[model samples]
Target: MSDAGPKGRTGRRDEAAFAITPPQIVGPFYPIRERPDLATNLARPMGSAAEAQGQLIYVRGRVLTPSGKPVPHALIEIWQANAAGKYRHPSDMNPAPVDPNFKGFARLTADASGCYSFRTIKPGRYPTAEGEIRPPHIHLTVEGRFDRLVTQLYFAGEAENLADRWLNAAPHPDRLIVNLQEPPSHLEKHAMVADFDIILASG
Candidate 1:
């Protein structure tokens, strides 16, 4: 089959004609406790003044089918450790202090244009039970009407990416790594932004 050229063109093919996002194992720390109404901001709860401690960042992206069509109202859930490399779970014995302000879990839905955005601090690297170091990444579960993708988002140019077993396992690992940059003038100032578009097999 021929390629669909670039993403914004009008002559794109059907969803089954393109490659979909790769899948990843949902590591050990899926949140257990009841999730707060986190909405999009993991840095601070709505109406609260306290913020999670670390370098604040904005994560924004779209959920689309392989054909480049939007998957509106798709459910997106994310979880990660705090900036101290500690998870707010009962099983994580990492010894790092958990930030009370940061729950590290959020659930949101993509808009009509398949767009979603959230604010949070960058997670820290943590150790595995086998003594291997896991790089900083955000775990995500995106459920579309017909498909669900489980994956991890990695940072670009992180030294640990070279040694991470989970990351290297992906056939196209470069697709999962994103560069953090300065946000636009309309968004918040001083925080970095990472734009990651998720293409599902079908929606």
Candidate 2:
């Protein structure tokens, strides 16, 4: 494939053609290699609000329209559970130690041209079924688009991924988008890398 020649020209832009490169392994214990019927929330992945604490993943991505135009000042909210399989939110009844260092949130004011970034930690897996732990992931809430979106981000290289029965519900090989970068690996206190994006239609 050729490289994209210019901003507006109809040329080969590998970056535009591709998205955050799909990671090697995702999903903790669900048949992630296959596609599952995840048409409903019950069959989909979930992230808590407790995952984004002291650490930072250096999350930097653009909220673009279908035409690839950045949407300035898009409000992006990320929430997820901690590495130990527990939520910092008081409502969560899971019996695990929640990391206090991680507040699990970072608000970015999109730049003049509509780009945003944040420094947050990677989320870990939680119980999806009896004695079962789902693969690590993050939940994102984007509010700048016409309609809000609630999505999940999964790791590309976790052993327990794809074994989670719930993930098997939506077993598309393409669902795995989370990947790890060497620059700043997972923190020793909390381990995992989760990156997710919210795509919108061209306005």
Candidate 1 lDDT at 61 equals: 92
Tell me the tens digit of each residue's lDDT in model 1 across 1-203: 54565543555544455467788999899987877464899989666569999989999999988777899989999999999999889989899998979888889999999999989899999999999998999999999999999999999988999999999999888888999999899877879999999989878
Q: Tell me each candidate's TM-score.
A: 0.90, 0.60
lDDT of 2 by residue, 98-153 (tens): 57555444434556566665555566667753667767666555556464544556
lDDT score, residue 65, model 2? 57
Model 1 misplacement above 4 A = 1-18, 36-38, 47-49
Q: In terms of TM-score, which candidate is strongest?
A: 1
Candidate 1: residue pairs that collide: none
User: Where is model 2 more than 4 Å wrong at Cα?
Assistant: 1-56, 129-131, 164-176, 184-197
